[model samples]
Target chain A: MTDPKRPRDPDPLADDAFDAALGARLRAGREDTATLSAAVLSRLAQDPRQTPPGRWLTPAPMAAGFAGLMTVAGVAGYLWVPLFGAGGEDAILAAALGGLVPGGF
Target chain B: MTAEARAKGASEAMDALMRGDRLALSRLIALYGPGIRAFAAHQLGDASEAEDIAQEVFLRVWSEARRYDPARGAVSTWIWRIAANLCTDRRRRRAVRRFLGLEAVPEAALPDDAMPGAERIVAGREQMRQLGPALAALPDRQREALLMRTAGELATAEIAAAMGLSPGAVEQLLVRARAGLRRTMGEKDDD
Candidate 1:
């Protein structure tokens, strides 16, 4: 834990006078407030916030959705290939030849 | 007005803004423009770019107002966070530009002659000339923490929230920034 009061580094401008002087100097160089405000307001008026409700459907979500779809397809293929052979040709023939077996009575 | 009252007013304004009230946005800019501009100018060391960044920050607020949750923090904190992020983006873009040799590195603009008084203006300009290099020498986060603390008059907790750091971390950044400035200024004074 760092001590709040510890003088880790000596600050020559630790006094209030230096703080005030620095603040004033920075403020003096500041851009005109009214001008900046007007520019901001004008820009805001020109390009009003038109964020759509579906803005959250960004690329990440889209990519995730695609991956999920691919995973489901892959899982279905894996199950199907094992249950019905690589092309399911034998299963198709068996279903079509139902009751036409050579030894059927 | 008390801090509570000011915050209440800001909350109301934000609510109005979320409800598509342009007047609320104008009011927000009126209230927070100077501080935002100062933060940008100090961080970027360029007045024109600061103005551009300030404009971008408010535009973002207008767009993102509905996402704001007052329970999380004040409107000022939200706004400063946007300003800081935009300034960082601009700095990164400027770096890329300079790396590609497409643009020269920008120097902080000297104080304009249109400043009201002559004598005081000259002295302030000299002070800023000294202060600019000292400020530019500090690391980005340290410079940012110090400027937001001092120029923006933001509380430590508010700054921490804006910078996504703990209050203690923000204080340490401030300390280091001040120490770095003092050393740089001392070196300048010696030469």
Candidate 2:
């Protein structure tokens, strides 16, 4: 005899049958993985993104250096007018040289 | 291998993949390729597209292996989530293309002449012919939950995570999906 307090298994047979049929049909839809995997690996090999991690590091430091140089140049250009008093080429040159040499001004 | 052993192996394989090990990726493909393909095939209704989706899923896996956290879930769950999202994105793109009057090329018809003795293929095509419309008629979330449950063989909790739903919501979606499928298929709702 089944336990009275136990929860009933609802739609047991029907659910199982439906799921089994569905799973079987889906399995039948399977494709050839070897060819697919080969294609995927080939694409991966060609993709530069998949290159070794440090392969990107080589360009990264160079990019950083270039960015740093640009930032310094930008700061210098911003301070050029203020320091040189917006006068002539001689003042600009003097300001630049003064900034480079400590207490030269 | 036991489930524990398999999980450990998968985790190790993922670590190796993150470290740029191609053999580990090959192992992963051998392990999870069929499940991904089947899920994509059922969801998209096109074998070639399914193959493409499967490959894309693995490529994403290879690219994003560093982001995988075993503490969050199993590796299979992570991979299936990627597959599910890719399938959803493809469907959405197709819909948008249709809306924009960009005529998407129709999937090529399967060549019936290729395999005369493949009884499973014959039977599956017939079943899909009868069932495809009903399956497609389901709401996207319900259909995804149902397919991940039935075809992907994922547990409810895993489905919830993949669908970004609470477990309770996932159960409700699944129940509604089953009822909808049964009603459309003309099955008696005895339960």
Candidate 3:
């Protein structure tokens, strides 16, 4: 696999030796998966929680959609306020502020 | 089993798994589990993490079967690409934990209290013990490339496709990885 013309090429023999050594070490470290296999297979069989850990929410798309919705809602609310009379504006402000106070709005 | 036979078995298992056959999923796990585990173990320096990866890989294979395109690559290649991606995510999370001081640096290998000093000095065992830290010391990409090559038993082209790199780039990575490992191991880099 080594080409002398290629600057990336090191000594071919040494590379092979390194690979062999690494491969051996990896093989030795290989996990015995009988118990894991059983657990995983049973989980698949029972259809326990399809999503992997920490991936259940899929936050990006949801967060983007939420932000878009909030922006549009804010813009729409701002635009609609001008059409409302001063009384309506006061009513809206009171309605919004009421929720911030203690007890039911 | 021959590579041909193994590939054939994995393909059949994948097909069955897509049909919702749990037994076929088990077979697929049996086929690729060791490699995925070894790949993860070497990458994360932890067996428990490796087990998590192996289990997750199978679950992913079960769920994402429809997304698989046989024309793109072999079954092993597809499975390994998933494993490689999971390993990347895991390593990143591990790094973040370390950065936040939420994690302490754990020993790379479990201490074998049963093995006496003389027995621990055996050449292969000693070399294997040394490798954990040496591998951990490697830069992420270099370590990943080497682990995928060695532990995943992936061809360079398969690795390239998995890593979204050209075959030439994969070759360069492999060469650099080997050189890095050599340097870490106190071997002659010129050699």
- Using lDDT as the measure, the top candidate is 1
Clashes (candidate 2): 0
> Model 2, B87-158: lDDT tens per residue?
877776677778998956555223222334778567656666666667778898888888887766666887
Cα lDDT of all candidates, in order? 0.76, 0.74, 0.76
TM-score of 3: 0.76
**Model 1: residues >4 Å from true position, as ranges?**
A1-20, A29-31, A50-105, B1-6, B111-114
lDDT by residue for model 3 (A15-105), tens: 6677866775676535355666897978876774488755533446569879999999999998888897797799888998999999837
Clashing pairs in 2: none
lDDT comparison, 2 vs 3, better candidate: 3
TM-scores of the models, in the given order? 0.73, 0.69, 0.76
TM-score of chain B of each: 0.90, 0.83, 0.84
Of 2 and 3, which scores higher on TM-score?
A: 3
Which sections of candidate 3 miss by over 4 Å? A1-14, A29-31, A57-86, A90-105, B109-125, B187-191
Query: Scoring each candidate complex against the real one, what DockQ results?
Result: 0.25, 0.20, 0.36
The fnat of each candidate, in order, is: 0.48, 0.42, 0.46
i-RMS, each model, one decimal: 3.5, 5.2, 3.6
Ranking by TM-score: 3, 1, 2
Q: Is candidate 1 or candidate 3 better by lDDT?
A: 1
Give the alpha carbon lDDT tens digit for every residue of A11-83 in model 1: 5456345555565566665645666667767876665654422333444667998999999999987677677
